[model samples]
Target: MAESQDELSYSLKREAEKKGFQPVGIARITKSKRIKLRTDALERWIEAGHHADMNWMKAPARIEAEKLLYGVKSVLVVGLNYFTIPENKKPNQLLIGRYAQGNDYHKVIEKRLKEIGKWLQTKRPDSKWKICVDSKPLLEKAWAEEAGLGWIGKNSNLINSKQGSWMVLGNLLSTEELIPDKPSESLCGKCQKCIEACPTKAIVEPFVIDSRKCIAYHNIENRNKDIPIEIQKAMGLWIAGCDICQEICPWNQQKIPISLDPDTQPKEWILDLTAKQAKEWDDKNWQKKLKGSSLKRIKPWMWRRNANYILKNNKFNSSK
Candidate 1:
């Protein structure tokens, strides 16, 4: 006998949890007004140049699910909590974003999603599946909220009531019909802590961020160019990506009960890295340290650029 949609949804969630995904939920595919509004907001954000040099955001597939997969029926969204207790840093040590402190999440999440997709195939042989991580053009966070995994908070990071904003998202789109969960409602409620706490003031307004002013964007994505003088002055100890907004969020202040996956735990070598060392690393050193990590994308030159900014900022601050 064929399983009911609810039964299938429950099975899918269980399969995802067994593979270490938390807060798994399903979202029915539809041309809803909310989806339209999100697409429209994305267009406006791009028009205002808030996306900076990420030209891929203009892909039409981001706004039209049909472009990605024909006859898509449901989206299975999952969150992987990557939060681990941070290590104390020496004054000379440079900071990296928490997400990049571990092995590449793209590899970790994709491997898990493929396993879930294979499990679904056994249950629904006719179903077609497409997996998405951060590289995809899909508006993943919107789908995540529609799946009841979490709401997008003021800092524009997905905020789960239980897991906080430290979770990375993944989606498995399928042709098989499944029950959809209720969409999450935002709980930010007039709090402006993220906006106030931004060292570079990148969060221009609630739910809006200007990537041109984002330290993470400049450090991680802006290549072959010098960081702006004003942004350089505010760089602090960050040598890769910035997390000031998420760190200041009240949603992230509470302790997360679940232990982090071993693959997502901070590597000791990454913790021991200092800005001075990053600025001095040769190509061989860069290749060895960041071989399996997401921070490899920063490139040796980008690392030097970011480290230079941090060292200059420290000198200026100490001289004051």
Candidate 2:
């Protein structure tokens, strides 16, 4: 029974596949009619001040799962693969997380999401919808979980059983009915590697991260002064974002080449620069190599700031 056999959601899934949404699953976001524990988890995280300087993540948070896609009867959850070559993983070689190796995913994923929304509208002319790609403060991991995209691993990133944690999530919130997918179970069972591997102990509890100690939080969100000295050194080779927890997870062991989505390819400039060269990197080089990049969010001075710490630890030695 299609929500509108006259308008196949399954066909929408297929079209999304051709357009490069590797996995497309629909999860309805119905009104809860009652305020629930969604607020409890959010309140707990805020009360503990785990969000750190990102006070914005505190207000207007969702947890009950359906509230995110509110007023929308169905959510089309999508994932885009963004993994790249291993050689590009070296710290001295101008490293970056696999996702940010190309243009910002927010732009890339949103474009494709709107295309799906467009197709749905064509099938059902009266459909109403919106495309979201982290642009809104939705707890994407929760949405992903509900849509069977993956489990929010101990690292706090969505880890697909097949693709590891190397994908960005996108969604189409619609005011049309569709069956919701079941959430994935935690395959991480008893494996505490990601929690243990966080250099700053950011994973204070299972699936609960304290951003104050998270390198990714400090590097991108905490925009004042030099990062705390205690964690600055622990921040280590994470020039922009820290992938330490994901890297150490057993789930990421199955490495595969991402065949689609230009968003996954590694850039040459980011792959070949020696730490010394990256240090001497001029304004022109920064713009050319990292423009429209997530790195741009970190003030230019912050790059020089965080990179200098990694440099001193290696004792000015480009190879350590």
Which one wins on TM-score? 1
Which tens-of-lDDT digit does each residue in 188-305 have in candidate 1? 9999999999988899988899999999999999985697998898888888888899988998888775546898899887788777688788989998999889888888989988
Report the CA-based lDDT of candidate 1 relative to the real structure.
Answer: 0.88
**TM-scores, each model vs. reference:** 0.97, 0.89
What are the per-residue Cα lDDT tens digits for candidate 2 across 70-170? Answer: 46777788888887656625645545567777777888888887887888888778878888777576666667777788887877788898888888888
Worst-scoring 10-residue span by lDDT in model 1: 311-320
Pairs that clash in candidate 2: none
Q: Each model's C-alpha lDDT? A: 0.88, 0.73
Indicate the worst ten consecutive residues by lDDT in candidate 2. 30-39
- Regions of model 2 farther than 4 Å from truth: 1-7, 31-39, 59-70, 88-91, 255-260, 282-284, 318-320
- TM-score for model 2? 0.89
